[model samples]
Target: MIFLIYGTDKDKSHEFLERLMARFLKGKNFFSLHRLDEESFSESVFNGLLKTDSLFLNKNLVVAKRLFQNFAAADYILSNLEILGSSGNVFVFWEEKIKDDFLKKIKKYAEVKKFDSAARPDFKKKKEDEELFKVADLVALRKKQEAWFLYQRIIMKGGPCEEVFWKILWQMKVLGLIKRGGGRKLHPFVLAKAKRAAGLFQEKELDGFLGELVQIYHDYRNGTADLAVGLERFILRV
Candidate 1:
């Protein structure tokens, strides 16, 4: 059998792959596993295994992650979908994203599962959180008036200053990550935006802003700075 587990919710898709493996291995006397990732996957390895049966095991479980990113590997796999689906071995494939045209062809022979980022539990932001996110985004774009206006609107609506502070902190951290993190953990769109914002400021300038925000947080803790007001001032300066 062939299984395709993929989408922007990579973490969830990977978890699904793990669960399938676990269920397949449980109560089994003998089993074989072959795992492929972007860095190490080869068409030769896949072809060799595809043509053979497990020596002592009932079946071979092949797990491939982001293998389709390699055009050659993807082409080979796509070309052989028929036999791969009918083989005694099991193949579980994972990808961050895939094209619909190719997916339709795979569906004929594989069990397809998708995990959309919007459907992910962790990606479900509250309405307030979206407002805060917009505020943070405006800050990234260096639009003082828009950022300040939204910040005030949030406050008027009973949104907490602490939430504002934390969101800005997180955005700043994302900017920093763009500078040095490569940030594979972040969603691609978020990373791309941060990267676009990175060129707007010098590294030293970003570092200074982080230093100042931390000091503001400390001052808030010490009752010397009102967080809401301080963030407003900070917004103007950044």
Candidate 2:
């Protein structure tokens, strides 16, 4: 049984992992709980612990953290997801962030949960972002001037930089999906808008733009860049 709790909401994910461990330990006298981390991860140790239980405990739970950021551990996990899934012990992987491709493969082998920090805007964001979706629509209509104006208006009225940034990124993702003709899962109105926006950029351009948007958020989180400034620059560049 493999369980993967990941994404940008580290606090929530960590709390959830602890709650789950508590539930698993309820009414239990002796249980084996093993932990692995980026600096301490070892394939040999992980494998040994997975198959070996203490004499005093009948069930074992192995909780791993941020191993995906470690190249060796990541590669080992990618190659052994199936084995981990079928193992007798419960395997829990707690990650702050993981690459999309790696996450996709892990989804097939584990009970997965993703907690995004951006899902809830900060109180400083207020309700000014109510019209933020309009920015995406403006882009689809190729009204760069109006898009920039609306974004500026929202930001001036307490709209969060993270919210606006994610909105623009979402627009790019939708456009990219429509460009690739793979937005069958999107809402009809959104799909229509994306079709209009898809013409504004080539596939490679959208990919590059998306990558840069992700980097901007990462840099902002790491305190290396201001999200508002980065978003302003990106919107101007696009």
Candidate 3:
């Protein structure tokens, strides 16, 4: 059997591949499983493996990761799709993305699946993010103690620091713009929040805080600071 799994949602796609392996392993005759990730990947190696047979096993499983990153290797695999798909050996491809044209051609021989991270966010995730947005609102309200406590609690619960930082930055920017009378076109709920948040800070204070955020980002990129640490400090200082 041949499987083609590629997607922008890497974690989800990876979990799907793991499920495939588990499902295939449920049978008694399944022998060995081989994986080719980018670090150990080569077209020649893959081709040789495909031609080799297991001495004592009914079938071997081959999993290829990120092969599409190498154009020549990807083309070689696609060109031999029929042989690979029809062989007794099981083949699987896991990629983050692939050319649309090549995908069309490979669809004839492989069972293809895609999970697009760029698509609309999942509803459950949206609700969780809404909770974080309220945290951002607390920051805008200058409720420092409450925001800091919630931030730590959320991080402890596995919320992403980068997401939290960006959310707060976005809310602050919106509030700053509304304070300057640019929020007339915003949604009623959004405008109301912006206006209320804007009242908590002077224009100069907002600008200074934004600059501090920029510096924090620069420090992280230069390896002098960690994002989570910097974000915590930012919330505490605010």
- Whole-model lDDT values for every prediction: 0.82, 0.78, 0.80
Q: Which digits, one per residue and each the tens of the lDDT, describe model 3 over residues 1-238?
A: 6899998775467669778888876878565677776566777888776775665655778888777787777778878998898777888888888888989988999999998765456896787687688789889988889998888887786665667888889887887787777978889998988888798789888888988888887675433577778888888887
Clashes of each: 0, 0, 0
TM-score of 2: 0.49
Measured with C-alpha atoms, the lDDT of residue 216 in candidate 3 is 88
Q: What ordering of candidates by lDDT runs from best to worst?
A: 1, 3, 2
Candidate 1 lDDT by residue in tens digits, 1-238: 8999987764466558768888877885355777777677787888877876666646778888778888888888899999999898888888878888889999999999998755435453477689898999999889889999999998886565777888998988888878875677889899888988887877788898999899998776443566778899999998
- TM-score for model 3? 0.51
lDDT of 2 by residue, 1-238 (tens): 8899997765466568878888776785355777777898888898887776555557678888788889999999899889888877888888877898998999998999888766546654445555777876776556778888888887685455666777788888888888887999888887777887788789999899899999998776543576777877777677
Query: Which of the numbered candidates is closest to the native, going by highest lDDT?
Result: 1
What's the TM-score of every candidate structure? 0.51, 0.49, 0.51
- Misplaced by over 4 Å in model 1 are 54-58, 119-238
- Cα error, residue 27 of model 1, in Å, equals 1.2
